[model samples]
Target: MKKLLIVSLGIIGVILVLSPWILILFGRNQLHDHDIPQQEQLVDDREKHLILAIFPHPDDEVTVSGTLMKLKEEGHEIQMVCLTRGEKGKSSGIEDEVELAKLRTVEMKNAAELIGADHLHLLDYPDSGLEKVGLDSLKKIVGELIAEVDPDVLISYDSKVGLYGHPDHRLTGRAVEEVFLEKRGMDGFTPQEMFQVTLCKKQIKIALKLSSSFQKNYPEDPKQGLPRPDFSINTRKFFPRTLQVMQAHQTQQEVLKDLMPFHDKVPTWIYSRIFDREYFREVK
Candidate 1:
């Protein structure tokens, strides 16, 4: 029995060691799984006045890609800031923190370009490890970007748990809120005073309720739900493009496989897609 136990343990250990590569090998399809010839929309304007997105990881950007793509196609000056390189993230299969960061940075840039936004900001902070970063450093880094972009509309994770409540996400919410309210009138700031920023509390709740309802009807599927959302953006038009952008994260194929189906099942006409909301206030 002891020998059998030993063999079992050895096999488990081998699986653990090889799991990352196996996931990567089989998951490579995720990277190239995009439907060819992205859908295009005919819109009136193609220049953004100013739109900015702040998120903790690469995929977070897609939470509101439909609105963003529309804005971009309409010619809104768009910019995105990814706080971390997602180095701590398990994707890309590279264990070296430095290399992983570099890889994700490239991946993010590629994703941003696909979205028609060339200005992508990478803070290069430690990934999934914001709890270890200096608060002062974080505030400053985020503040500088806010000042530079001075975006008319800002989107980010709800400081609350509307978007998975990751610590890094929370930090993004906190930092952006802090900077948006306090960094006004600072040098290099191009203020967009009338801009409306969107957040995801209500939509998350709606997604949750809807997900619960679906799960109840179809218990065979794993239960997943988001919180209710106040607003819903129809992203079906942008799914192909967004899917391509999200696929750039090479390591997040499984996540896509799991979530995309749910997202697709959502009604295209009334998908409860909500983003968190925090707007800038001029400094006193």
Candidate 2:
């Protein structure tokens, strides 16, 4: 019994040490397993266009940074509106809410600049409290921004997944959807397209299987349906720039740093295979 216990402990240690690599391999395989659909690149004759992305917090922009960069490269303007400063987010150190919110604001500004966004609007809503916010009030605030931007393209989270069921994410997504639908028939307010940032259901399933830590943080919920992307943007060319944008969020590094392995530690082909695409479901 003593010998068996010793061997079990050793195996557990080894598994823990190798977990990251195992997850990477699993992710790579999962990408190959899916027959991902791609759409023809968008072409617009307009000399200048505006894209407005509404998200819940500071780091949420990273979810679509690569796609945003591609849009900017195509001579379109990109703007971001974060509903909160992430005051309730986990701190890397001993920072209080006020200190953390201030830090995140600067980090977001830097990230926006790196992504070549034309503007960023930071709405100082209370973090972790969006669910409690009045729907009409949230819609009014977002509606005002939509009116000001008159964006040609709009982006936000998918209310279905919210990529792990974060309440703020779901709330923000709902608000954006409401504003988009409400303004569609209004004169001069119809956006050409609206998309929700999302992950493939297969990818999420594989991630849950490979990382015990991820599973612990985001338990598998059969009821939490996934979004089926209407089209996927090939962002392989801009993946490096995307990483740069993510790195700019300095205070969020502890959470973001793990993403580096997809760029650095993995083979270039593997990195491209797994992360060179950003998924989006078009809102009709």
Clashes of each: 32, 0
* TM-score of candidate 1 on Cα atoms, chains taken together: 0.62
- Predictions in order: lDDT: 0.57, 0.77
Q: How high is the lDDT of residue 238 in model 1? A: 66
Residue 36 of model 2 has an lDDT of 65
TM-score of each: 0.62, 0.82
Model 1 score (lDDT): 0.57
Off by over 4 Å in 2: 1-28, 40-48, 210-223, 257-264, 267-270
lDDT of 1 by residue, 251-277 (tens): 665555433444354443222221111
- Best candidate, lDDT-wise? 2
